[model samples]
Target: MKILVVGGGTAGTIVANNLARRLTAETRSGKVQLTMLSASDRHMYQPGLLYVAFGQMTPDQLYRDQASLLEPTIDFHVDPVKKFMLDKKQVMTEAGKIHNYDILVIATGSRIVPDETPGLTEGAEFFYTEESAVKLYKRLREFQGGRVAVAIGVPHKCPVAPVELMFSLHDYFKARGIRDKVNLKYYYPIGRIHTIEAVAKWAKPEFDSLGIEYETLFNIKEVDAKNKIVKSEEGIDVEYDLLIVVPQHRGMEVIERDNLGEGGWIPTDRHSLAMKGHDNVYVVGDTTNLPVSKTGSAAHFQAEVLAENIASIIKIGAPVRDYDGKIYCFIEAGRDRATYSMFDYETPPDLKPPSKPMHWFKLSYNQMYWTSVRGLL
Candidate 1:
């Protein structure tokens, strides 16, 4: 049977690897053809982008060639997916080539929709892309200290990243002896700081200690770039010399055009991660509309469960694995201290609450970032 995995991001890579390893051993004699499609050769380490903005990681460390990350058993297509014909079970590339597959995995992931917000794309700088991260790094270095605002648009990956950025910025200015001249403000659309209540509780005290002003349920309506002003739906006007905005996110165009998603995100079974209507299709990582934080750790856990179910289906024509909506996040609070949160479907796991030991754990993980680069993780 032929399997086509689209998109070569974190989810795609892990799923492809797991499937190849499983099918090779199970099939024994017959070949299980696997192919991966991607738009570019650059495989970005998205999680590292946050560190890149803080000048902690270099550009070279944040990206690698996609070809190097894949196994030789899987065919790699370095072209964009222009369209997907669901009825025909084929994917057509921008180059006018079509690929037929017995089973398809849509791991195209989500993209930042900066245009969704009025004037956001024009006014504020974003750290989502490699180029933008580099630019933001430069801007941060040359900054002379002024009102800095960090805001989050709804439904973003790594929910705590913006808060981490704020902490890092605060530490940066404090070390430069200009902390007193800078004002940092964090705004979120939700009624609470974090979707996970345990995390929000931990974050409140941190914000209080850092003296960072936070506004919840404050939706940013528009950005007045020329005037360096941000207007919220609550009639709050925030003036800033520098703005860091996390734009709105949506499923990739490939998924949207094929009607594979609901409101731009693929709807999947919370347990099996199989597409709601299509049995032969599965989605993992940031592509799925799961009730969990869209972080790399969440994707990793989903990949493990999804791979097991796919293997079961291939071997016995039945699903065996189930996802528990697991997610773990490390919130960097600068100066080598961070808070960690572990959660599942019911509630955030009780990891004895956030403490300094969690900070060390985060540090150790950061040092092992090379493991992901080497594809060892």
Candidate 2:
């Protein structure tokens, strides 16, 4: 059995590593072979991007060589995917390499396209990438203080990140002793500040206490970046000294070009994460069109569930496990304190106020993730 996993991101790495453990016997007997295809050699710790912007972490610490994360027995290829020939069960690489697989796992995730919104790419600073976070850090330091508007253009990966960004920004400015000088505000298209009603309810009082104003249903129609103003379709206008935005996120262009997604997102079973009509192909992470937050925790749980299902499928042609849509998010609430939320599809998030103990746990997770998740999980 040939298992080809595209992407070396959080979901891909978890599934690949766990599969290697579960199929050790088959792999040693040459009955199962594992391969991972990555566009870049680096596996970016995306959750650390916020810390980088807040000057809490350095860029170098957030990335690891993808090749080092895998066992030597697994085939690790640093090649960009050109397209997918699903009908032929072939993965076409940019270097003209074609790899055939009996089972393919598509964990390519999603990408943020600044070009999706006019003036957004050029106008506001985002914290999704290393360069963007670094630039935002510099810009945050240089700004004396004024009206700061954080906006969202479209649905993004890590849906909770924008909310967390607002909290961190508040903390950032407060630490500088210029919190009053900065009139911080947040705007998102959703009807509520957060998708989870319980989370929003928990944040409402917190936002009220922090004097942070927020506007919902504010859809961005144009970003007048040069004028430092954001205009929404409803004629709502906001001016800002600094614009922090979470721009549009879509599935990889390759998935779109190959017509494998619905509006650049893969349609998969919410429980199994298997691509519809493609029994042997599976997907997880941001690329899947699930009405859930694209957080690392979601991917972590999905990876475990998918790995088990794959093992069962290869043995008896039926996936026995199901994903519960579980997610855990640790949100920083300024200073060195954080709050946590845990939930699944059937349950609402149980949220609490920020505390120092949770903060320490959040800090510890970074090291734990880099070392080994088996114990932590």
Candidate 3:
């Protein structure tokens, strides 16, 4: 059996590593072959980008050589797939090489498209990438007492990030002793402060306490950079001295180009994580159109379940597990305090109060992320 895993991000890496370990015997006997294809040779801890924006972590600390994180039994390649010939059970790479597989795992992650919104790329400061994070950090430092508007775009990676960014911004300005001078206003495309009801309920009071004003149902339409104004689709215009935006996201271009899914999100089974109508083809992470946050935690959980079922099918002639839509995320609530949310399909997350200990745990998890991706946690 040949297992071809694509994308090399958190989801792809974990599933590939887990399969490599679980199928070690079969692989050694040449009965099963595991391979991974990724665009980059380096694997990035994406959650750390938030810290990078806040100056808590540098970009260099967030990466590891992709090969260093993989198990020796698995064959890994940096060539990105350009074509998905699912009917032929093969993929053509950018380098014009063809790879055949009995099973395919598509974990190609999402990307931020600020340019989708008119004038947003030029007018807003977002920290989705390394360079953007550094640039935002510098912008935040040079900022001195003005209207700091934080706007959110839909279908973003982390669902809780808008609230988290608000909390962090409040703390950042407060720490700089300019909290009184900075007018922090938050805008959301939805009807609430956050998409998660529990989080919205919790964060609203917190925002009020911190004097963070908010306006919901403010979908982004365009930015008038010259006038320092942001116009919403609802006919409301907000003038800002500085704008920090959480841009919308879409899946990789390869997925879109192949017409595998709308906006590159593959239609996947909620439980089995397999692409709809294609049992042998699986999807995970941001590539799946799952009703879950596009966080590393979701990818990690999905990978575990998907890997287990695949390994079980290989070993026992039947699959053993189902993904329950389980997702866990740590919410950094600022001021050296943090909390977490854990939920699945059948249940909503119950948020706890932020605490210093929880904050410390989140900090430690930044380093532990590498271990977690290695299938150790």
Candidate 4:
């Protein structure tokens, strides 16, 4: 039997390593095999992109080679998956590598589609991907004091990132001695600034303290890039000297192209992480249409449940585990302070105090993630 996992990010890497360990005996006896696919050997620590964009960290600091994180038993293909042949139970890659699997895990994550919004690419700078983060870093480096507008073009991955960027931008301007000259504003598409009530409750005062105005119920209809203005569908317009944004996030192109998505997200059983029509296929991370924060912690929690179920199905007959959509998000308040929140499926995150100690924890965790992925942390 063979298991094919179609991602190599936080969720895919963690699940593959866990499954490899659980199926070691089978692998050793030639009874089972595990493999993964991605466009490259590199796995970007996505959250770190925020720091990289601010020049607080180097571009190379945000990535790790997947080979270092996965077990030696796993065969990793640094190739892009072109299409999924559901009837054939095979995945075709652009490089002509055909893969067949008895059990499939579609952890392809999310893709940021800026083209989904008109004039957004022309006016706004987004930092979700490594390439975009690097570009933003260059832009931020040369930017002088001006009105900066940050908004979400659509539902984005890493729900905490835009807020983090706002806080970090506050720090960035202050540190550059232009805090008095620069004006920063954030417009959210949803009614609330965050999905988690506790997070939104605590963030309000903090954002106000930094002089960053937060607006809700702002739906972006278009960006007049040439005029340096963002127009909302509700007849509101924001003028800016520079614009930063989180672009619309969608399921992998292959998934959408194959009609495997529900409104740009792959629908799955939140509890079991399984696709409805395919008993042997599971979805995780930003790909799932779960009403939870699409952070790495959420991915980690999903991976644990999915990997256990995969192991059980291989040994017994069916999955017995479930995911509760748990997540822990550490919000960077500024250069020296941070706050965190934790919650699961039916509960709202309880607010936690912002502290410098928590900032160190977040910084320390970034360096320790490699060890954690290897099951050491």
Error of 2 at 266 (Å): 0.7
Local accuracy of candidate 4 as per-residue lDDT tens digits, 1-377? 98999988888888899999989999888899999997778877778888889888887897788788889999888987898887888999999889999989988888888888889989889888788888999888888888889988667787888778898998888898988988888998878887667777788888887788888988888899999999998789999998898888777878888888965578889899988788888898888888876778888889988988899988997887889868888888888898888888777678778899999999999988887666444
Clashing pairs in 3: none
Question: What is the C-alpha lDDT profile of model 2 across 89-135, one tens digit per residue?
Answer: 99899899999999999988888888878888777899999999999
Reference-based lDDT, each prediction: 0.81, 0.86, 0.94, 0.85
Top TM-score prediction, candidate number:
3
Q: Candidates sorted by TM-score, descending order?
A: 3, 2, 4, 1
TM-score (C-alpha) between model 2 and the true structure: 0.97
Candidate that beats the other on TM-score, 1 or 4, i.e. the better one? 4
> Least accurate stretch of 10 residues (summed lDDT) in model 2?
368-377
* Candidate closest to the true structure, highest lDDT: 3
Which wins on TM-score, candidate 2 or candidate 3? 3
lDDT of 1 at 21: 72
Q: Each model's RMSD to truth, in Å?
A: 2.1, 1.5, 0.7, 1.5
Model 4, CA-based lDDT: 0.85
Q: Where does the lowest 10-residue lDDT sum fall in candidate 4? A: 368-377
TM-score of each: 0.94, 0.97, 0.99, 0.96
Error of 2 at 60 (Å): 0.4
